[model samples]
Target chain A: AQSVTQLDSQVPVFEEAPVELRCNYSSSVSVYLFWYVQYPNQGLQLLLKYLSGSTLVKGINGFEAEFNKSQTSFHLRKPSVHISDTAEYFCAVSSFSGNTPLVFGKGTRLSVIA
Target chain B: GAGVSQSPSNKVTEKGKDVELRCDPISGHTALYWYRQSLGQGLEFLIYFQGNSAPDKSGLPSDRFSAERTGGSVSTLTIQRTQQEDSAVYLCASSDRDQPQHFGDGTRLSIL
Candidate 1:
């Protein structure tokens, strides 16, 4: 089984400032990582994914995540943020193969202020 | 449809009542999944269907919860004798094989 852990429950940042949401995972076998964002009363939208290849994966809304295999972490970061970026972000993981279910962490609510 | 579609954007039912939620996966998508989002539990996988066959159903909370997919297109999740604790947003997602999954707006189920 795979599991995800989001270190922060909430993150508050000012517009144009950088932010990072921490995530960790545990699994005996290899896994794929993903980040999804959800606005108020909306469904989740994919932010980025780390399937394989480059360690740094870029996603929509200027968001990116670095997959550190050694640390077992895939933290999402944004060099510059906007007020519109405020939303609930979730870190999810799945097995590298098969019909594995996506295991998600407790989301981190990002609040970007002006 | 352009994306996954879930019916009855919001549902409010009394305790002990049975509720059924529907999901229509994207055309040609062979994989469909059901998840629940709540304040306490966050996002929890409920079920997954791969062309009408459920290979993973361990995420279902209890026996009161059951789901079925037919014709590899539509799916329904039924909760028998729903409890207040069942209140949450039920999300549906679909994918093509091992590709990224797209989500629906979800059905907010509130049991009073």
Candidate 2:
């Protein structure tokens, strides 16, 4: 079984400032990583995913995450955030094989203040 | 092309009542998934359907929760004897093999 942990429950940042949402995972076998964002009253949207290849993966809305094998982490980062970026973020893990259901963290609420 | 579609954006049901939520996946998507999002919480997997067959239904909370997919296109999740704790958003997602899943707006279920 795989599990995800989002270290921060909430983070407030000024607009145009950089922000990082930390995530960690535990899985005995290989796994894939993903970040999802959800706006108020909406379903989740994929921000990015790390299946294989480059350790650093870029996602929509100027967000990126670096997959660290040693740390067992995939922290989402944005150089500059906008007010529109305020949303709940989730970190998820899936099996390396396709069609597996995702295991998600509790989630982090990002508040971008102007 | 249409994305995933969930019917009855909001559903309110009384305790001990049965509620059904429907989902229509994108055209040509082979994989469909059901997940639940409780207030202020992350999504919990409920079931997974590959075509018309569900290979993984382990995530279902209990026997009261049941789901079925038909023709590999539409799915329905039914909760028998709804409880206040059953209040949450039920989301449906679909994807091609090995691709990122696309989600629908979800059905907000409120059990009173």
Candidate 3:
């Protein structure tokens, strides 16, 4: 079984400020990591994923995340945030060995203040 | 190309009524999934269908929840004797084999 833990329930940042949303996972076996964003009243949109290779992954809207295997963490980061970036972010994990469904975190709500 | 599509963007009914939600996956995608999103439970997988294989129902909360994929394309989620706890946004997603799932807008079901 796989589980994801998003460290923050909510994060408020001023426009143009950098922000990081923390996430950690627990799994008995190797797993694939993913980050998704959901705007108000909309479904989740894939931000990025870490399957293999490089530890750092870049995603849309200038967002990026690094997969730290030793720490069991996949934290999302952005150099500068805009008011439009305010939304809910989720971290998910799936077993690397099979075609399995994703296990998601509770989510972190990012509020960018202008 | 069209993404996953779900019907009845919003639904409201009494606690005992049965409800059905629909989903149409993107053409050519072989995998489909159903999930529920509530206030505290961010996202919970309800079931998944891959090709003609039997769906995985391990995430379903109870027997009142059931889903079926017809003709290996469109899928329907049916909830019997809906309870207040069933009120949530029901989401549908689809993807190619080993690909990331593309999501639908989801149907917000409200039980009165």
Candidate 4:
């Protein structure tokens, strides 16, 4: 089984400022990591995922995340945020074999202020 | 290309009534998943279907919750005797093998 923990419940940042949302996971075996964002009244949108190969993975909307193996962390980062970036961000993990369902974190609400 | 689609964007029903939510996965996707989002519980996996194999019902909270996939494309999630605690967003996702899941807008179920 895998479990994810999003360190922050809410993040407030000014527009055009850099930000990082922290996430950590615990698993007895290898796992895949993912970041998803959900806007108001909308479903979750995939931001990025770390399956293999690279430690830094980039995704849509200028978002990126780094998968740290030793630390068991996958933190989402953005060089600059926009007002539209305000949303609920979730971190998830699943077995590397793809046989297990994703285990999600409690989510971090990003509030990008203008 | 169409992403996953879920019907009944919003559903309001009285407690003890049964409700059904539908999902249509993207074309050719062999895997589909169901999740629940609530205030108390953030996001929770409910069920999963992969091809013709037996669906994974491990995440289902209780026997009152059930789901079925027809033709390996469309799925229906049925909730029997709903309660106020059941009010939440039901999300559906689909993906190809070894691919990231694409999500639907979800059905916001409100039990009164």
Per-candidate DockQ versus the true complex? Answer: 0.64, 0.70, 0.62, 0.65
Q: Write the per-residue lDDT of candidate 1 for residues B62-97, one digit (tens) a residue.
A: 999999999999999999999999999999999886
For this target, which candidate reaches the highest lDDT against the unseen true structure?
2
Candidate 2 whole-model C-alpha lDDT, 0 to 1 = 0.93
lDDT of each: 0.93, 0.93, 0.92, 0.92
Predicted complex 1: CAPRI docking category: medium
Alpha-carbon RMSD of each model? 1.1, 1.1, 1.2, 1.2
Candidate 3 structure quality by residue, lDDT tens digits, A1-114: 778999999999999999999999999999999999999999999999899999999999999999999999999999999999999999999885125688999999999999
Q: Interface RMSD of the predictions, in order shown?
A: 1.9, 1.6, 2.1, 1.7
TM-scores, all models, native as reference: 0.97, 0.97, 0.97, 0.97
Q: What is the lDDT of residue A80 in candidate 3?
A: 99
Over the stretch A46-90, how does candidate 1's per-residue lDDT look in tens digits? Answer: 898888899999999999999999999999999999999999999
Ranking by lDDT: 2, 1, 4, 3
Candidates in descending DockQ order: 2, 4, 1, 3
lDDT of 4: 0.92
What is candidate 2's lDDT per residue for A27-114, written digit by digit as tens? Answer: 9999999999999989989999999999999999899999999999999999999999999999999995358899999999999999
Q: What digit string (tens of lDDT, one per residue) describes model 2 on residues B42-100?
A: 68999999999999999999999999999989999999999988999999999888998
Model 3: share of native contacts present?
A: 0.55
Interface RMSD of 3: 2.1
Prediction 3 global C-alpha lDDT: 0.92
Q: What is the lDDT of residue A39 in candidate 2?
A: 98
